[model samples]
Structures are given as C-alpha cells and as structure tokens.
Target: MDLHPIEIVGRHPGPKILILAGIHGDEYEPIAAVRRLAGQIDREQLTGKVTLVPIANHSAYLRHSRVGTDQLDLARTFPGSADGTPTQQVAHAITGLIQQSDLMIDLHTGGLAMEISPLVGYMLVSDPSTLQKQRQMATAFGLPIVWGTTASLPGRSLSAARDANVPAIYAEWGGGGGCQAAGVAAYTAGCLQVMAQCEMLPSPAAAAPVDRCVIEDDRDTSGHLQLNYPAPHAGFYEPTLPLDSTVRPGDELGRLHDPFTSHTTTIYSTQTGRLFTRRVLPPVEAGDCLAVILEDPAETGTTNE
Candidate 1:
C-alpha cells in the first residue's frame, strides 16, 4: 500500500493534526477539500504540523468504488496486522499515523450510492476525560451535528484512534461519487476551523457560529436519533424526499418496486428527523441500507439553536 502523506511543518512547535480523506474511494469532496487546503496554508504563519492524506484508499479511489481491489473496505480494517491483505496493510499504516498525531479528523461521505449532509462525529470512550476531548474536537470542527458512538467497531479507522486514546472526529458531507462545490468549500473551511481550534493556526477573525445538534448513543430508549432504514427486499428504489429534507413520523420516504413481480412497497419515516442519506442507485438488494434518518435536534432537545 502506498501512503501519500502531505506534511506541513510550522515555524513554531505545537499540536499535530492529521486530516484523512478518501477512505472510501468514491467520496471525492473531502479529498478535493484537503488538497485545496494543503495548497492554501501558509507554513510560516502556522504554529504546528498538519498532515493530510488526500487519498487513503488509492485502489478504490482509482476504481471509484467503496471497496479496494482486494474486495475490502479500508475503513473497517484498522489496527490491522503487519502481514495481512492490501487493505489491512493500508489500515496499519493509517493507524501508525494516527498514533503520532495529537488530534485527527477522518473525512467521509455517502459514496457512490448515497448523498449525505455535513456532520461531525466522535467515538464514545470509556474515560470521561477522553470522551470530553473527543467532544471538544467534534464541536470545534464547526459542523451543525455532532454524533458520538460507543466503542469503535472492529476494523474502523476511528477504532484504532480510540484504542490509542487519541482525540479524533469523523466528518461526513456530500456524496453520490460526484464533487459538489458547496460541499468542498464547507469541508475546506471546516478543516481550517479545526486547525485554528487546535491552536495550530491563528483563529479566524470571525468564526461562524455553529447551530449544533448533539447525538449520543442510548440504545435502551426508543428516542435514539440516528436511524438506518434498510431495503426490505431487492428492487428498484425511487426516493420521495430530497436529501436533508425534514420529516415527521409516518412520512413516506420512498418506494421500492420489484420489476419482475410488479410488487411495490412504500418506505415511511418512523420518527421526526432529517433525511441525511438516501440511496441513489436504482438497483437494491435485500438488507442494503436505503436511507438514514436523523432525529431532529429540536425535537430531541439537543439543539444549540
């Protein structure tokens, strides 16, 4: 695995912030954002080091697919074995880089199949202090939403960082394998804000006020805001609502139609939230994720409006 590490060292020593992108090859907004940022930074004015990996999964990036040539997802192979598959090797190298950073940000999007809204997320750690650190970083990223999950699932890039006790956040915005100007600009600006927050660079004169929505894991309750809607059966999907559309419970999300059987099923929203993700591909398979519903922060009383 060939790792492209773009490092910018400042005149004065400070925290090291690592920004990673292209973990999923089909997501291009973050890669472009990071590359643009790398070109704009003035090293002489910077106080710390900044490392940017514009394309984390080179093979998948070339193919414009989520998985690499080895038929593996790089995001799920963190803390990987030294002698392992190609994806695993890449994961190991990425983990090593995370270990060397004071703060980290993993950039992601919905990829080829779906579109996503801009959001920042951190992993829920065992220690209160560590979790607090993660929260601060996520909040500082200036995204409207901040989500925290308990434990990193095996092989996830953030899992390695969590295990290392590093403060990190994952950012998602834009998707469908195409670049959006707004998405790229938002990501680039957000990266700069994070660097300023880390004290790696001077703070901007007027930082944008973030209307934050905090999502925490509470599995025991039905009020959990983050929700995933999977394909009920294999068919062609046609979404009823646009991405980022606000909805109430019982709202029709889309329809899944079986061409061969002439059967149609309507997908409905179970809770009040924003439609952050929706599958763009017409072909679907049973158990495939079709849409992601995020509970409205106002309804959940988690909004900083």
Candidate 2:
C-alpha cells in the first residue's frame, strides 16, 4: 500500500489534526474535498499542523470498489495485524497515524449504493471530557445533522481512535459511486471550519449549530433509531420521497419493482425520523440497504437521550 501524507506545519507549533478520506474507494466527495484542501490551504497561514490522507485504501480506490482485492472491507480492519491481508496492514498503518495525532476527522460517503445528507458523527466514549471534545468538533463541522452513537462497530476507524484515546469525528456526505459538485463543496467548507475550530486556521463567523440526535439501532431495544432499511428481494427501486424528507411511521418510502414478473413491493418507514440516506441506483440485490432512518430529535424527546 502506498500511503501519502500531505503535512503542513505552522511557524508556531500547535495541535496536530489528521484529516482522512476515501476509506471506501467508491466514496468520491470527501476525496475531492481533501484534495482541494491540500492544494488550497496556505501553510504560512496555518497555526498548527494538518496532515491529510486523500485516499486511505489505495487498492480498493484503484478498482473503484469498497473492499480490497481480498474482498475485505478496509474500514472494518482497524488496528490490524502486521501479518494480515493488505487491507489489514493498511489499517495497521492508519492506526499508527491515529495514535500520533491530537485530533482526527475521517471523511466518508454512502459509497456505491446510496446518497447521503451532509452530516457529522462522533462516537460516544466512556470519558465525558473526551465525548464532549468529539461533540465540539462535530459541531464545528457545521453540518445540518450531528449524530451521536455509543455502539462502535468492530474494527472501525472511530473505534480504533477510541482505543487510542483520540478525539475523532466521521463526516458523511454524497454517494452513488460518483462525485457530486455540491457534496465536494459542502465537505470542503466543513473541513475548513473544523481546522478553524482546532485553531489551525483563523476562525470565521461561527457556523449555525446543527440539529443534534442520538442515533440508536436495533441493538438497543429502548433506542428508536433504525439505521437501515434493507431491500426485501432483488429488484429495481423507485424512491417515493426525496432525500432529507421527514418521515412518519408507516410512510411509504419507495417501491421495489421486479421487471420480469411485474411484481411490486412497497417499502414503508418503520420509525418517525428523517431519511438521511437512500439508494439512488435502481438495481439492487437482496439485503442491500435501501434507506437509513435517523430518529427525529423532537420525536425522541431529547437530542442525546
């Protein structure tokens, strides 16, 4: 794996903030955003050090696939072993980078299957102070939504960061396996805001605070958030609602049509929330995620409940 680091150190020593993108090869917006930032940021104007890894998974990136040549997901192989697969070795190297940084931002998108709303996510850690720091960084990203989740999927970059006691935020926007101009613009602006908040760059007028929500999945019975809406069977999907649409329980989200048999299955929302992600591509296989429903903060009675 070829790892390239774009480092900009200020005249005065300060915090070291690491920005990462393209962990999933098909997610193009963040890759574009970081590349733009790499060229646009003036090292002389920076107060601290900023290191950007525009493409983290080189093999997958080359193939335009989410998984590496071995079919292992790079994001799910964090803190990997030295004698493991190529993806795992890459993960190990990235974890090393994470350990040396004061703060981190992992950029992501919906990848090949879906399009996502602009949002930032911070893991809920055991330490209150660390959790607060993560939240502050998420807020600084200036996105419309800030999601807090306690459950960290094994081997995820954020999970590895937590193990290293590093404060990190994961930002997601855009997808469908292609780059979007609006997505690139949003991510670029958000990264700059994060740098300003980290004191690496001069602060601009504060970005409007976002709507914070505690995202809980099926793992927690009391938690109402249902992150995934999967395709029931292989078919073509036609979305009924637009992205970021406020949805109520039982609202029709879309329809799955089997062209061969002319059979149509209607998909409905199981929770009251906003549609944060949706599959834009028509063709889908069984069990593919069709949409992601994030529980509405107002409906849940509190933002972080």
**Residue lDDT tens for model 1, 228-252:** 7888889999999998889887999
What lDDT score belongs to each candidate, Candidate 1 first?
0.82, 0.82
Model 1: weakest 10-residue lDDT segment is 218-227
Backbone clashes in candidate 2 total: 0
Query: In model 2, which residue pairs have backbone atoms overlapping below 3 Å?
Result: none
lDDT of 1 at 148: 77
Pairs in steric clash, model 1: 76-155
Q: After superposition, how far is residue 76 of candidate 2 from its true place, in Å?
A: 1.5
**Candidate 2, 88: how far from true, in Å?**
0.8
RMSD of each: 3.5, 3.0
| Candidate 1's TM-score | 0.90
Give the C-alpha lDDT of model 2. Answer: 0.82
